[model samples]
Target: MPRVGLFIPCYIDQFYPDVGLATLEVLEQHGCEVDYPAAQTCCGQPMANTGCTDAAVPLAERMINVFAPYDYVVAPSGSCVAMVREHYTDLLPLTNKLQEFQAKTFELCEFLTDVLKVDSISGSFPYKVGVHQSCHGLRELRLARSSETVGDDFDKARQLLKSLDGISFAELTRTDECCGFGGTFAVHEEAVSCMMGRDRLADHRAAGTEVLTAGDMSCLMHLNGLNQRHAQPFPVMHIAQILAGRQPEGITPVNSTDGSVA
Candidate 1:
């Protein structure tokens, strides 16, 4: 079994702790010796995305130092893993340490499918789900084929979800469109951000999905906020939560006006 370092994002740690717990549980069940460094915090994505490299450097160094010794470092968020794998080079001086850290970091689904060669999971998610392909996960990590790209395609998230019992995927019109929750982009450009989120939700609504699942909770947080604001029926969930067979707290099935599950 590999010694795994679980990198729970700062937002996940502070707000959606259940996602972190689900990630830990799922990895441990797969025969991994998982470790969580409580001192871990943000990967400095918010700061670095806003062009504040000065503020992000310390966080990057802290991350590398803490997880560098582990056999493998995995995170539930594709965006966070992208930060370490792609952006750490720009934030830190070019050295073997930086390259070593980047090489070992992986997104949870990628590690499961690519590294562990896991074809199926021991969980059941009996619901119609719409997959929201966050930008970093689709493009940076190549977890799924982008609709914009031309080639034979595959979807890692879809691959894992299909292995679960009684799980059906919704037919999304824009299969790989951005959910528009680009970390700081949401706060700085609220109007555009909300518009893109609304458009993404419309795609999910058209597919008649009962739940929205994605690799990144930040995208889900933005999308779910819009769902509640508009009184949409579906709930947003992390892929980890679904694969771990953990129902999110307070997520009841959407009911029709006549008080029946829709």
Candidate 2:
């Protein structure tokens, strides 16, 4: 079993402990000895995305120092992983330490497919769903190829969903488009952000999706917030929770009268 450092995003640590828990369970179940270093902090994505690049410097150094020697550093959130992968160089000069950290770090899906070579799992998610390809995961992580490959490709969520016995996933028209939850982009450009989400939700509605699934809860949470405000409802799940075959342990509220009532 390869020893790994698990980097839980701040959102996952605070709001979505289930996602972090599922990540731990999934990694450990597959024989990776995972440890959460106490000193771990935000990957500096919030400040970086807010255009505060310099403010992210200390956070970046902390992460680099804390996890550099691990066999791998895995993160559940694609957006956070993308920050380490894409924006690390933006903060400071490319030193050997930076290079070493970048090489060892991986997004959850990327690690599962590339390093673990895990094609399938022994789990289940019994929901009809729409997959919202997070912008960072799609654009930054480069998880899928937009080519003429004639077969089903396994992304992190879809591949894990394949393990389920009765879950059905639908292919959307714009499969890998953004959900408009680009960190600070959600607040800075609310109209465009929401318009993009409404468009994504329209497709899910058309497909009669019971759940809107993605690797990043940030995107799902943004969309879900909009949905809640408008009294429109749908379940948003992190891929980790979906893969671990865990559901929120109770009846979830649903909107009855459209946007008029919750």
Which structure among the candidates has the greatest TM-score? 1
Q: Which ten residues in a row have the lowest lDDT in candidate 2?
A: 253-262
Residue 231 deviation, candidate 1, in Å?
2.8
Q: For candidate 2, lDDT tens digit of each residue in 65-95? A: 9996689999987889889989999997899
**lDDT of model 2 at position 171:** 67
Off by over 4 Å in 2: 146-154, 230-232, 248-262
Candidate 2, residue 82: the lDDT equals: 88
Which 10-residue window in model 1 sums to the lowest lDDT?
253-262
- Candidate lDDT values, in order: 0.88, 0.80
How close to the true structure is residue 192 of candidate 1, measured as C-alpha lDDT?
A: 96
The candidate maximizing lDDT is 1
Q: Please provide, for model 1 over 49-158, each residue's C-alpha lDDT reduced to its tens digit, 9 standing for 90 to 100.
A: 99999999999999999987799999999999999998998988999989999999999999999999888987666677899988998899999999888998899989
Model 1: how far is 120 from its true place, Å? Answer: 0.4
